[model samples]
Target: MKVIILAAGYGTRLFKDLKNDRNEQFKHLIGVPKPLLPIGERPLISYWVEALKVRDDISDIFVVTNNHYHHKFKEWAQKYPFVTLINDGTSSNEERLGAVSCLQLAIDKFQINDHVLVIGGDTLFYEDFHLHNVIGQFETIVKDNNYANLVLSYPCKDEETRKYGILETDENHKVTALREKPSPTDTASRQACPCFYVLSKDSLTCVQTFLDEKKNAPIEEKDAPGHLLSWLVGRNPVHVYPVSGRFDVGNLESYITCHKYFQQNIRNIPTYLQ
Candidate 1:
């Protein structure tokens, strides 16, 4: 299996917040991508790299970023020899290819025909998010349904439903529907789906099919992975694995919170790193 981390977003919101800060120290963080920003003792993405590096099933790790931060990602990639960084040739957020297109680009560039694990670059799970366990569940589901894909979900408040891709699942945890940022009354399910996913080799072709059909559609419709999963759920079975929550370091406040959490709690949890 190959792992692709979507880091192509320009993080306009985060940068905007940083730019207005009065602290001189924040100046250094004004332009840094969310994935590369400091989180605890290391960069935010390093946690992910360390956790997956030891997995025998994972053959490669790919980080897809924009041309605006391509060089910065390249500098960070040097620390992890196993990681391959791809620039989407997008100089700014406005010119960026959506997350789905970036994923498709990596698939085409590497000719990936295996089961691919896709994750958002700015996201991370808590202590219990073991890669082995996650992959094992995916493999177990595949045994019964070859076309099934696994995604992570966490419960959110009713009012927060509009901020995420709300997933409606069956008693068996199979995704029945996905609503991207729907209003609170749209569904009673508070299961918010994140970017983590496992797509089978058979399902790999669906990316191109989606792109072809949505060619005339705006990038906003394709920007989030939820859009792809929302479409995929219609064609194939997608399962949900529950977690307490994830640390989404999109803005300055979240970054600080994530850093503090890892710093204080990492030792209490079992880690994959040697």
Candidate 2:
């Protein structure tokens, strides 16, 4: 399987907070992309890159970023010859193609025909979350159904359902449906779904199929991968892989928290990069 890291978000919320200066400590971070922001000893996305770089199951790692941060990612990508970067030709959030569109761009540009492992650049799971285990589970799913897909899910608080896309699964753990940012009372399921997924190679073309079918739909409908995941659950066998927890560094506070978590649990960090 190949890997695609979605990092094109404009970081509006974090930029707003950093622009407030916060005693001038955040001045340096004013315009950095969330995925490139410093976390612990390295950039946030670097942790994911380092972990996957060592895996033979992964073929190539592609990072899709907007033109605004293209130069910045170019500088970073210089150190890793194994990674390829795609400039989505969008400089701002309003001009940006949503996450799913960005994925389509990368797939088209690279002509990716293999199974792809999709990861959110600004998202990080707990120290105990292992890609080895995740990939193993995904492989098991594929063994039963080659067209099946796997996504990571972690339990979230009842009141926090509004903050994420929740998953509804059957007794067999197959995703029955997805409610994007549903109200806490909308459903009893609290299986907060993250952006991480292992999409089968045979199902790769379905992304373009979705975009074409929803050609006239509002951008909001095609923005998040959850929309596509929900669409996939209907036609394909989408299963859930439970994770303990994850840190989505969307704001300054969450970024700091993710950094501190890594710092305090240094030993748990993967060392495959060395």
- Best candidate, lDDT-wise? 1
Q: Which stretches of candidate 2 lie over 4 Å from their true place?
A: 271-274
Error of 1 at 160 (Å): 0.7
lDDT of each residue in 227-274, candidate 2, tens digit only: 999888888899999988899998888877888877777664656222
Judge candidate 2 at residue 223 and give its lDDT.
Answer: 77
What lDDT is obtained when candidate 1 is compared to the true structure? 0.89
Candidate 1: clashing pairs of residues: none
TM-scores for the candidates: 0.96, 0.96
- Per-residue error for 15 in candidate 2, Å, reads 0.4
RMSD of each: 1.5, 1.6
Compared with the true structure, what per-residue lDDT tens digits does model 1 show for residues 1-274? 9999999999888898788877755778877899999877788888889888878899999999999999999899888988999989999888989999999999999999999999999998777677888898999998888888999999899999989999999999999999999999889999999899999988999999999999999999779889999999999999988988888887878877888888887884337332
